[model samples]
Target: MSLNPPDLRPDLAPKMRLDAPRPGQPTIGMVSLGCPKALVDSERILTRLRAEGYAISPDYGGADAVIVNTCGFLDSAKAESLDAIGEALTENGRVIVTGCLGAEPEYITGAHPRVLAVTGPHQYEQVLDAVHAAVPPSPDPFIDLLPASGVSLTPRHFSYLKISEGCNHRCKFCIIPDMRGRLVSRPAHAIVREAEKLVANGVRELLVISQDTSAYGADIRFAEERGHRAHIDDLARDLGQLGAWVRLHYVYPYPRVRNLIPLMAEGLVLPYLDIPFQHAHPDTLKRMARPSAQTETLAEIAAWREICPDITLRSTFIVGYPGETEAEFQYLLDWMDAAQLDRVGCFQYENVAGARSNDLPGHVPEEVKQERWERFMAKAQAISEAKLAAKVGTRQDVIVDDIDADGIATCRTKADAPEIDGNLFIDEGTEGLAVGDIVTVEVDEAGEYDLWGRLPA
Candidate 1:
């Protein structure tokens, strides 16, 4: 699986020329928003900044410089990004903005007057250099030096590991095509090296992420560069060999994904897959500018489950896409009922400014959108509870995350994919555990979205 591409010159650290301030660094305040992919990008920049001797400040109040990594996936997200930029301007410090939102010329120019510069995923490495080489400069001593250890702003136990960047999908509701550009996957060997580094620093779980993970190897110049194709299955195989508990997220269930089911069944990778199938109705999908082969897509899912019987499939549905009829929404709900999905979430469609759907006719009203969203979630919550209840008598491996002040212990299982997913709650007892310790827990009770469990003595 270590198929190294011949053309990619591997450099563990590529040297970049940026002027450095003499003997001092400033405290950096970083705010990362959006999905796991954005988090991974933020992590890389933060790692580089810390390596360059910048002290990280928890709050923006006293920091000498501020960096805001933003999300531009939806209209609401764009508004929040603008709000963050305004807040960063109030700091009276050197400001930097990056991420999909920074790709917008109007947003960067209009909102962030105080920002010294703005960059996107294409210029992440360069942005770090800019932060270091600021003319006003960081006030601390040892400016040109790197930190002795990599600092993680997140909880120490787990981290979001991104495999690649950007998307190639042209779904009408999505603005990623306009914002993040096309899919550009990193070499598998490089990703493995990065994962090894993260593991050395205490990350136990690797969340394999991308906009469209199944399309991983398509952009990779495999024939001339590598002797093989750069695919998610190959990537998953490589990551599984790392011996960390690996998880896959944002995987689209295309026909090619069937090859990955066996890897999931092997237990090296978790029996979980995140597929964002927006809607099940074929006509609705076509109007949304998505793949219209409804039967084939469902057949692929059926085939995957046939091979990997234990797959914990999670997907998302959008209720209010333009031109979606009442019958179409009902069809999606009925499809959900038929699929018996283990985990599911529903989002009401939003008309993003740059997306094509904004101008589409037959837009669902706000009240109607809200009602559909509520109805779908109401059904989904029941299904989620039933699925968790089924596991009430089983023992699952969970990473212990905390012992809260109220004597409640919280953690997550391999089945849960952090942030947006469910958690495992254990009543505090004399067993005595600390964060990052993986233990076997017996589930005793189940709630709407979480499992109540106790660590084995």
Candidate 2:
């Protein structure tokens, strides 16, 4: 029997199948960590397990075994993943660890040697095998069958659609390619069919994700349709017809990406781009093995804004990479000021063990990195505040995410993504409002990060 409990932890996977078991049937609990991409993997795993008649327990104590989908993107993330493993082991005793951190099984087994199994990212079959060995599924096809809605960790209104797997970029500081392997695009028809199913099942928004969305059709040679191949442009065109908000994420600023702008303008897709600029300085970008020509990119940004004035461009940058001089940091600041990007995220550099950046010269000291991070955040915050202040008078369409017991509703506009970006709060006129309702709100107040708006009486 399925027990649908609201997942309180935003960081945990949203689409979990918390099914209470039949007598003598094994139930598996999972603690999913890391980014939305990793969470998607967890969703896929749980979906497969559910199909195999393996019930999912919401808490570790009630489960026959637990799966910990981990993150190893940064040192901090790895530490958190390890802590989660310890927590699971302490609570349930039977734990299986997997994900990016699982790529290095020794690191995990060294800390928690009693874990049932450790497997790397995308090793869904191995994870199932481990689960079978620990808590085998006993299927009663008629009794244990799943719903047509499928297993999802996200809310019913939205879903993260991973169009491809892995990265082709060899950025010095990143090991995603190592952890998740090279680019592998799905067939166009397959993606569309999944998206169509999602929309048909009441998914109102689709967050398209991958290591590099711009590199989507490259691996598959773009042959997804009847000889048309699965290219992003075509994929966007096809998915746009599903009558849901299509938000593209992790798109590199490749030349081909420009082709997608017109779709946003034409109202086929949301006018939002979550690109990672990394660093603005040419020298720093070169050291990190990224595109260093900022001039053209800035020009392209201007051109994109011209094409779609309502477009919201979001980007992330690394502030204190190894060998990142003060001038380079200043260039980044200056670029931020000039670009006036709609949304921004900054990170101070952390040395991953196997990354080439660790071997580079002039690693910034920790104290300096921290100070630079403060300065970098200050600059971005000021820019964000100014940009948000400009939107105070405009009316925006907002999708309600949640409403509290006190009747206050929290919502997001097309420009605001689910978590990373800001939110819109509805204080008054929330009588008829409900989560997932799309309503018009007049921007009345703006803060450094969030906005306050209310519906018309």
Candidate 3:
């Protein structure tokens, strides 16, 4: 996840202050880490504080306290989260920690004993109480009036719309179910209302995220209302009418997900799927405890492509599993050749604490894991090059994201998601173009992982 580690710095939070202000008002600075789900949690926490008349500081220097949202998904992430907490202590002196890593409060306080308080993941009330004890807010309506539109931690042009919380999967290599608990989806109306507000606030794209997007409303049993069920397809179709690009993430390849292909085909949603197919070999998948992995995914992919010819399948894989063999790894590479997935991410398996995979037999050595990771990445890169090369001379609609120091505009096609997937670079003919504007670009250059293009005449 280092590719785009959770953006915890206060710089990512909303630039506008929702709190009006009072004399000697308390200001809180936040540092969020982990996945988009965790990011949403941090946003909610800050929004609550803002409503209570606490000002959000974009830097730690002026803030009375800081909240360090941590990620405990991987050992490496845990170490980084600890380092962030320590930094908060050194820089601000008054610090409270929350997030997945906060589940092990002792582990954190053991490292940063001076932290003011520690709370577990998504414990909004506990976090607020901790902040109150540390630095109480002094609301003066003269300065701080609570606004209906809450503070966001993402760029105003785009926002992450988290549909649900937690997961029910028992993948042996994962401890998410242990930390986040079972799936609990929000009602379709609430999701639509939030998307409506975001779009009204000038958000051009909404990236729908959750632990298991395909399982949305499963726990709700597809409760019906106003002729729409609470399922993802219903939620997605509802969100599509809000005049913004709706992209789905963290979707499992459940058979029922095929119903969404028509929505993509009809331009209601982006023709993209972000599936996490951890491994290809049945034995390795079985060892990982991802029973759904044994499904005929290739056939499913073919059917999806048949429905939406322009669909771009993006997936992540775990290489060097505990019991992975040369044959099993080769099987993954061969399957990649057959799948021709548009985008891919490869991670070397590591023993995350509390995950069942840690004690699994046949643990590959560090050197072996590193070697396999390099080979796996090389193959994925080659595939990316070929896939992108095929787009040369093709014009694609792109949403501008950034203009680099060199004045090149960074953008993404419908096939690309923010931060993780590749981008298209616009080096010329971008007169007066701004971020979030959708425009067509003719592909002029293709790198292994990115493309260069320009506005057409």
Whole-model Cα lDDT per candidate?
0.74, 0.85, 0.84
| Clashing residue pairs in candidate 1 (N, C-alpha, C atoms within 3 angstroms) | 23-142, 23-143, 24-140, 24-143, 51-146
Candidate 2 structure quality by residue, lDDT tens digits, 1-457 = 0011122122223444354666666788988887788888888898898899888888887899999999887776777788889999999999999999999999999999999999999899999999999987888788878767677877778889999998888899988889999999888888888898999988888999888888888886878575435889989988898899999998888777889999999999999999988888888988999843565788889889999999999888887799988888888889888888988877778887688898999988888877887898898889889989999989998888889988899998999888778899998779898777888999999999899987875
Q: What is the Cα-based lDDT of residue 30 in candidate 2?
A: 86
For each candidate in turn, the TM-score is 0.88, 0.94, 0.94
In terms of lDDT, the poorest run of 10 residues in model 3 is 8-17
Question: What is the alpha-carbon lDDT for the whole of candidate 2?
Answer: 0.85
TM-score of model 1 (CA atoms): 0.88
Which residue runs does candidate 3 get wrong by more than 4 Å? 1-24, 226-228, 404-406
lDDT by residue (120-210, candidate 1, tens digit) is 7547776776787662334334444553325554566676666667787788888887777888887776777777787877778887878
Candidate 1 C-alpha RMSD relative to the actual structure: 7.9
Candidate 3 residues 1-457, lDDT tens each? 2422334111122222233334476899888877778888988998898888888877778789999998888776888888888888888899999998888889998998899989988899999999999988777667676556578777678888988888988999888888878888888778888888889988999999988999998898978766567899889898888778989988898898899999999999999999888889999999988948645999999999999999998888888899899999899889988898888877777778899999999988778877887787788889999989999999999999887667789999989887778899988767688888998999988999899998888
Candidate 1 structure lDDT: 0.74
